[model samples]
Target: MIHKLLTREQIEKGYIRFLEKNPLALMKVNNRSQQIEIILGKKLSNIQYIETANILVEYAETIGIDSFEYLLLYAVESVEERQKIILLRDELTKHDYSVNKYTGNA
Candidate 1:
């Protein structure tokens, strides 16, 4: 199970509403080697929270995710758990290699 920043109703509705309104928020997940390096010259920080609801959405785009995983990105959130997710994503990419495999990545 994953920590939640919103109720069931909120997750259902809010996730859709967010995607509809801020399509760009859905695209900020992987700037690691490209734009961030080009614009910022260096990674100032992890790709935590870039735009509206970005961090939470990034959390959703992970492999084998349930509803509330990404919202767990918090002050009390464990870095190890997040590392596991990143590893899972990387492993999946090794097989598929499609950005659109995850909706949040697209």
Candidate 2:
């Protein structure tokens, strides 16, 4: 589930927590945010942007950095698209070894 709407200060605090955990993820997060801006042709609302950032950070923590970048790219799409990508991601992660077994030999 997505988070409650966050104030600017709350968002900043959340980012600080993310930074404390993964310093290298900052650049990737910034790049993803910029891509979102380009796709939308304008900046996101504070709440939208903050929620996106939080989602990315949380996913990065669970999924590892490489896969998280791919996830962030999906996040640039519409909400329905993001949800679809997330469901696919969850399924893939659940059957990660099985996926690799098929793809690795192909």
Candidate 3:
């Protein structure tokens, strides 16, 4: 079974990186040139993740039910976490966590 330990973002990034490094394998599995572009997320396409699934099977050390689903979920989760961090950082920069300026009472 693929480790559920990995968060969504890690899987997504790893999967994308895998594609970048292994273009020939991608082309062979996709069966068409048009589909490959879609997988890269360069063009609006739904089949990108699906195509990645094939690579997973070939490269994955192990596989089980809903492997692709899990990977996708982790990827999305990772992205959400990053967005939250950005927003939080912005808020932190705007204000300091300190005692009220007017209230002299500590």
Q: lDDT (0-100) at residue 65 of candidate 2?
A: 67
How accurate locally, in lDDT, is each candidate?
Answer: 0.47, 0.54, 0.53
**Predictions ranked by lDDT, top down?**
2, 3, 1
- As for TM-score, the candidate ahead, 1 or 2, is 2
- The order by descending TM-score is 3, 2, 1
* Residue 24 lDDT (model 1): 60
Among all windows of 10 consecutive residues in model 3, the one with the lowest summed lDDT is 93-102
- Tens-place lDDT per residue, model 2, 7-48, is 345445545555455556665566666777777776645434
Q: What lDDT score goes with residue 20 in model 2?
A: 50
Over 1-106, each residue of candidate 1 has an lDDT whose tens digit, in order, gives 1222234544445444554554564455344434665776765333322432454555567555633444434322467865665566556656454656555554
Model 1 alpha-carbon miss at residue 61, Å? 17
Per-residue lDDT over 5-94 for candidate 3, one digit per residue giving the tens place of the 0 to 100 score: 345556667567666667875675456435566556455234555567665555553546344443444344466764564456456544
| Residue-pair clash count for candidate 3 | 4
- The ten-residue window of minimal lDDT in model 2 covers 1-10
Model 1: pairs clashing at backbone N, Cα or C within 3 Å: 59-70
Give each model a TM-score. 0.26, 0.36, 0.37
Candidate 2, residue 24: lDDT: 60
How far residue 73's Cα lies from its native spot in candidate 2, in Å, is: 26
